[model samples]
Target: MMTRYIAFLRAVNVGGRQVKMELLRALFEQAGFKQVKTYIQSGNVIFDAKGQEAALEAKIEQLLQQNLGFAVPVCIRSIAAVQAVLDNNPFPGVIPDKDFQIYIAFLQTLPGKEATAIIATLQSDIETYHLNGKEVYVLMKKNTGAPPFSNTYLEKKLKLVATTRNLATVQKVLSF
Candidate 1:
């Protein structure tokens, strides 16, 4: 069966790298994806493809490097997977409104034990995180301004490529 997938791309449209979403969408289509749709410009591509998520990840990364002239690490999750992420959020009562932004950072791989311990050491009142497999749920209180547990911090401490999206954005992607 065909699956609706969200390709959460990392290192796109950030740190001086410019990638046009329209061009990225065209690459996905040229790579054999259907029902192509893009969310924002942060490299969120929702497309329909048939294959294992791992294969799709590799395929898209290759296509991006070849066509876009940069390596974009992609983490693919199905619609059901995204729904499960919402259902599995560890911070139950924290509503993702203007006051708070609940984000899920998709990791390149499951963090190792050492990395998990390091992440645990980063516990703070402003930011809270829970790691489940390759996904990390981060709750950021808007009162804190910029979050300490940013994608850069997570990638640096965990030594993995990570792409984050707010719960609100995930909900919007599900609507597509």
Candidate 2:
């Protein structure tokens, strides 16, 4: 049976790399995905296909790399998995606003105990994180500039591939 998945692509349309949403959807459709749709320009693609998550991720990464000439990492989650993340909100009653922001880092795999320990050491007053399964919920204070840490920092520290999306974006993707 086909499964519905949201593929969160890393580094799309950022840092000099630009990917048109139309092309993205076309790529998925050409690869046999059904009902392929892209949300915004940040590489959020929702589609239906028959494959395991890991296999699907690898396939997409390969397809993008071959076409876009850069390594585009992919982290996919089923609709149910995405819903579960919202259902188990770590920061309850905390509404995101101008001063505060919430981000969810969708990881390729669950972090190990050592990685979790590293995360504990990285938490601070400005930003905090909660790890539930493969998702890392990050709460940060909006400042004059960008926050000290980012998805790249998390990937380096956790030693895993990850793609991050704002809580609002995740919710919007779900509605697609």
Candidate 3:
């Protein structure tokens, strides 16, 4: 049976780069996905495909590169897995309207604390982070553009590949 998977694409419609969501849907369709839907402009897609994680990731990445003329990282997870990630967020009940934000940073493989200690040390007043398995939950209570205390710092500090999506987008994806 086909399983529902979530693909989080990096650098799709941000930083002066623009790719229409309809185009993204079509690309997935062209690659033989059914029930294709996108959550937000940041390249969150849900589709049903018959395959394993590694194979599906490669297939989607190749299709995206061929259609978009560049490389974009794709993180894939099963629907139930994604639901558990959201349900398992330990930092809920944080202020909802403040500068607070929660992001799920998907790792290609779970990293040891020794590998992430450097990033851990760089955090300051603007950040608080928690690691739950393959997901990193971050709470940022500073200005919106204040260097995104959670994301950029983690990637730089860890030296391992990762991608992030806000809690709002994550919920939207889960609702699909």
lDDT of 1 by residue, 68-87 (tens): 78788999999898889888
Clash number by candidate, in order: 0, 0, 0
lDDT of 2 at 64: 92
In candidate 1, what residue range of length 10 has the lowest lDDT sum?
A: 141-150
Worst 10 residues of 3 by lDDT: 144-153
TM-score of 3: 0.88
Estimate, for each residue in 1-176, the C-alpha lDDT of model 2 and write its tens digit.
Answer: 99999999999999999999999999999999999999999999999999899999999999999988999999999999999999887998889998888999999987887877887987888888988889999999888475555999999999999999999999999998
What's model 1's TM-score?
0.91
Of candidates 3 and 2, the better by lDDT: 2
Show where candidate 2 strays beyond 4 Å: 144-148
> Each model's TM-score?
0.91, 0.96, 0.88
Which has the better lDDT: candidate 1, or candidate 3? 1
Predicted candidate 3 versus true structure: per-residue lDDT over 1-76, tens digit per residue: 9999999887788777688999999999988999999987888899999999778988988998898888877878
The lDDT values for all models are: 0.85, 0.92, 0.80
Those runs of model 1 whose alpha carbons end farther than 4 Å from true positions after fitting are 145-148
Regions of candidate 3 where Cα sits further than 4 Å from its true position: 144-146
